[model samples]
Target: MKINRCIAPLMISVILSVAGCSSSSKEDQVMNANLGAQALYDKARESMANGNFAAAADSLSALDSRFPFGPLSHQVQLDLVYSYYKSGKIDQTLATIDRFIRLNPNHADVDYAFYMRGLTNMEADNNLFQELVGIDTTDRDPSKSKQAFDDFRRLIQQYPDSKYAADARQRMVFIKNRLASYEISIARFYMRREAFIAAANRGRYVLEYYPDSDQLQQALEIMVECYDQLELTELRDNAMKTLKLNFPDSQFIS
Candidate 1:
């Protein structure tokens, strides 16, 4: 009877101790999860501030998965987009922006989302005809550049007073110059091949569409050359007159 009583007390103590330990472990796990989430968020912010975008992205991704719909979720989503952009993951950047836009169209930062999408595409431009045309079409697509320009334009149209408006205007100028240069290049190629009509038409198109382009002088000069080659005396004289009127001191005209 005495031994039985002793064994019973010892067994109860052991059982209680085990239960206490398990309870403590469960609490510790909860505390650790909360702390880990906080630590991850802090590390992500630090990495972003330090320009370690890849590390920040990884940390933020962990936080996102662990604490989905948590208090910091929205901020984490935006940070992920910025992180992808800073890390040079252009496609990811675009996709993230699209996702954000689609998810939160009325969010306060929606304009920024659009602006970032435009900026992403603009930065990824390859400036190669073959790459732009996908190797199947010999034609110069310019669609990527056009998409970027249209995006920026949409931001300006919808959010005229946005902080990105000035930047969008600057990007538009760049797009215009790029388009003008492409046209001028095609015109010169035609000129070299003695395709005078094609060359003149291309040059005229540039002059008509991109009057503010830096290539204006070169385009007019090409027109003058093209008309001269075709023996169109009136058109050649007219092109010369226009060239002189626009760029009297241009080296090409002189």
Candidate 2:
């Protein structure tokens, strides 16, 4: 019995030693993963700063695989988003932003995340004025501009104290002006097609809904022309009076 007891104690010691080794192995693995992630992160940053966005994306992706939940994982993910954006991979950039927003809605830098998404979409706009001037052959997709403007507006509304809020507000103004101009363009197209009532209504809608728009004067001028073509003399006079009252110096008024 004593020998059995001695063997039992020896067995316990062996088991404990095995358990301790297993625990140490796990800890070592964690440490190695963290180190690997940090090394990859450093390399990725260097590559990005040197304008090697593709290399930076690959390095960061490697870190993601090696240390999926490691300490630098979040930062690597964010950097990956920026790398994809800078590389002009629009779909990947948008997908990464969506992932970040879904995963870390309450994160402190969530505002910046949303801001980055807005900036990405905004930068993709090739200027509505250029499109309007017939310099670009692309079909006008106001939807993209609308998406960017809405995203920026959401950022400003949700994170008013964010550093990007002011810039977002300014971008919103540009977007609004473009939107109003597009409306005026459509109004003019309707007038040219002898759809005078449709053109008059569109112009009136712009003046009413977008009074602060930079295109307000042009919209009012379109309204005056449309109303006169429709023989709505009273409406034409009213539009002229309103345009003169609001923009006496506007070239459209003269």
Each prediction's whole-model lDDT (CA): 0.83, 0.81
Position 223, candidate 2: lDDT = 83
Q: Model 2 scores what on Cα lDDT? A: 0.81
lDDT string for model 2 (118-209, tens) is: 87887676665786787732236667778888889889889999999998889888887777777887887788899988988878888887
Cα lDDT for residue 130, model 1?
62
lDDT of 1 by residue, 1-254 (tens): 45687699999999999999889757644544566777878888998999989878877777877897888877888898889889988888888788888888888878888898888887776545666676532235567777898899999999999999999999999988887888888887897799999999988998899999888988889988888889999988888898999999966575
Which stretches in model 2 have alpha-carbon errors above 4 Å? 1-35, 127-139, 249-254
> Candidate 2, 27: how far from true, in Å?
31
Worst 10 residues of 1 by lDDT: 134-143
User: Each model's TM-score?
Assistant: 0.72, 0.77
Q: What is the lDDT of residue 124 in candidate 1?
A: 74
Query: Candidate 1 — which residues are off by over 4 angstroms?
Result: 1-38, 65-68, 126-142, 251-254
Relative to the true structure, candidate 1 has a C-alpha RMSD (angstroms) of 15.7
Best by TM-score: 2
